[model samples]
Target: MTQTAAQAGRPRTRRAPRRLPYLVRQLGTLVVTLFAITVVIFGLTAIAGDPARDILGQYATDAQVTAFQQIHGLDKPVVVRYLDWLGGLFRGDLGISYQSNGPVWDVISPRLGPSVVLVLFSWLLTVVVAVPIGLYSGVRLRGRRDASLTFLTLIVAAFPEFVLGLILAIVLGIWLAWLPVDSTAVSAGGLFDSPTAYVLPGITIALGTVPYIIRLMRANAREVASETYVRAAVLRGVTEPSLSLRHILPNAAPPVVTALGLQFAGLIGGVVVAETLFGFPGMGQLLAQSAASRDAPVVEALALMIGALFVIANLAADAIVVYVTPKLRDAVR
Candidate 1:
């Protein structure tokens, strides 16, 4: 009985140790990521010109600027300011905007939704269109069909987002009149309210990502298609759709998922120029305004938010890769 009890206790003891390492690693990653973000935020704030002057204007006296800086704790050491910022971040207080004189979250949170909506719609559209086309091109190999598709993808990919955004704005918004040209505000008509406003932006974002996904999917599918397993299945008269979807796509998913996560992270920041050009009110636009106004708190908060998003997205991708590829999980074990 004592031996059995000891054995039972051993399992619990071993499990605790296993968990400790995982916890340690997670904490370490958080610390390192936060430290790096702090450095970047500080550097950006320093180069962005005097926040006090930006807040008070050029006509403000030197004493006024100095007093403002002192009141805001800008007179403190950089390390102290960073620590204070980090502490505030932990407590969900992102600080006030010097320009807006409002809570940072209040200003940024509203715009975040619009940006997310745009990116999510674009991402879904890209995936839906790219996957099948990429699979088709890969399965067809060097055929005329594949060559045609590849050429088209390259052409589309080569086009810059702004250029595409302009062409789309003119073609769809002006000539076709399918969407609004300059409107960026979301309406009570819901997501489908302003096709003129949202459609072109969505399409531009989607188009920017499509070529990358198509290329990645095509390469991965082609490689999987050439594998012995796929060849065996083909020889056995396996149905094309089933074989591609079940056997091919699943195996080719790791890199695709990785690319998708990275693109999603990039979309968070990349939407700035597109959002600005289109007059969209999103986090990107907010960041642009904050930077232009030298709203240090808002700008720093936005930078940290974007950085956190990137890190989280990467972590999510890693988890997904491990989940899908047992080999990876086992390696970790």
Candidate 2:
């Protein structure tokens, strides 16, 4: 009777916390993280030099510079400017771009699609190519195949991303002539119309990212394979494929999923370099041009946008991890 009573009471004692409160806490953390990012973005502007001078040019008279500063609120103190900017953001106004004299969103909106496409293509391709090879390599650890694969990953990792881009551009775009040399056509035509334009850049990014993911997956798979549950399954005579796919893969996936979320965020920086190289009309290209022109508003908006994405990516990764891991789901609740 006592055993039955204790068993019945266990669930009540260990019941998961309310899901609403858990979500509310996550949202609060996201808001705090985004606010911190905005502060850092504004802080960077302090060292970006005088935006008024940059916009007005060195030959502009002092009176003209003062008028420009006054018009753009550049003459205001940093704190006031930050508050005004924050208020504008709350109102969905990203401010006018110094380079284009247009709403920053207008400039950013068109370029957003290309970057999204590139990131999706690159991430998906990396996962498709990396996951199977990584899992196989892990299952075959210490063999000649593993050594060769590891060596290749190291070789690829040794090259800078741009270097890899250059090589791909030369070989595939020039030598084989299989894909477009640059993404300029994609900018002129829509992505669907110039799908080939994505190929080189996408491959370049995939090659750059794959090595890290492969190594991470391999490490994770090996660790998971050694777990007691896996050993028990092995002793019970589970087939290799079932053991790897059913038992090992599921256990190994959580960290990889989190890494993938971070990898997506990290791709923003890589996209900048790739887009600039390929002449892709994306946020990356715009960011380079805006920074070069000292377009502070555009630059600041881009920085904050990227920072927000980073925070959101982490939150997303955490959510996915919690959803997939029963222990994590209960603990987080």
Candidate 3:
């Protein structure tokens, strides 16, 4: 009453603590991580031998090499080059690709589609399927159902993504001749050109993801199911499934959501292997080819882009957590 009366008498001096779950900390870490990525990527030039050699070849005369270096600004100090590159990055220029002789973004932009389609499809499928199965498995923890699920997940997770993709390619592409062995299906015309091409890649990514999400959800559900509220719900004539859906699932969401974010971010890298196996012309494929060709600018841009994506994914997860948990939302405020 006193506090309320005082607030009415004057503006309340104490504001609710400004909160947004872990957004502030995550943003700070993201900044530091991005900066570190820049530094590391820039430092790679030191070990890149010489751009003149990579670009012009050893057969070129010293005069030709010097001219090449000057024209491309390769002769500049590392810090100066990095600053120039960083400035260009902010202005939506990813620099010129040494290999393609065009703007890096222009070269990489078209390839972005396949990676986006593949990852989104994979992530959506993973969540849609894993969440329900995990919930059921969690409800049946330690029972035959859970045991079977655990074993199945183990088998799927045991194979590396590339291995699974390879086996699929051989079986679907070779033995049965059901799908294209290569990724020409997604080339140039986009995913609609050959929707079937997406099925194998999507399934490959899904197989890798399902096991991890299943494990996270199952563990979290079990922990939530054991909580007092769920126990009370069980006592009140509520079935385990109903209690799980109502009382346990929501409470178990934070960790699962967090893991999902990490998994999504990880899929960016995973697609590199997938693209390699499937021969899809995505950012992952471009990044691989650029790295091999010693196209430093392209590599740097691609690495930073992926890093930025990871930051975005983690931020999204934090936002979801803040929106869903009322107690957490209030505490943050």
> What is the TM-score of each predicted model, taking all chains together?
0.82, 0.84, 0.81
Candidate 2 per-residue C-alpha lDDT over 1-333 given as tens digits, one digit per residue, 9 for 90 to 100: 999998988865576545666678889999998998889888888667687877778899999998888878888888999999999999999998877788999989888888889989999998998888889888766778788899999999899888999999999888989888778887787767898888887887788779999999999999988899999999999999999999988888778877887787677668888888898888888888888888889988988887787778778877777777788778766
List runs of model 1 lying over 4 Å from the truth.
1-27, 187-196, 226-251
Residue 61 of model 3, lDDT score: 92
Top TM-score: which candidate number? 2
Off by over 4 Å in 3: 1-26, 140-145, 222-254, 326-333
Best by lDDT: 2
Clashing pairs in 2: none
Instruction: Compute the lDDT for candidate 3.
Output: 0.81
Show the lowest summed lDDT stretch of 10 residues, model 2: 12-21
Per-residue lDDT over 1-333 for candidate 3, one digit per residue giving the tens place of the 0 to 100 score = 999887789965688666554667777878898888888887885468567776778798999988877876788887798899878877988888777778888888888888899889889989999998898788776777778889999998999998899899889889999988777668857467887777777778888888989998998888888888788888899986678788889888778887787788777767778887788888888888888888888888888887788767766777677767787777666
Give the CA lDDT, 0 to 100, for residue 241 in model 1: 86
Q: Tell me the alpha-carbon RMSD of every candidate.
A: 6.1, 6.5, 6.0
Model 2 spans with C-alpha error above 4 angstroms? 1-20, 140-142, 220-251
Taking the tens digit of each residue's C-alpha lDDT, what string does model 1 give over 87-182? 998899998778777888988887776777888888887889888888877776687777888899899989988898899889988898877777
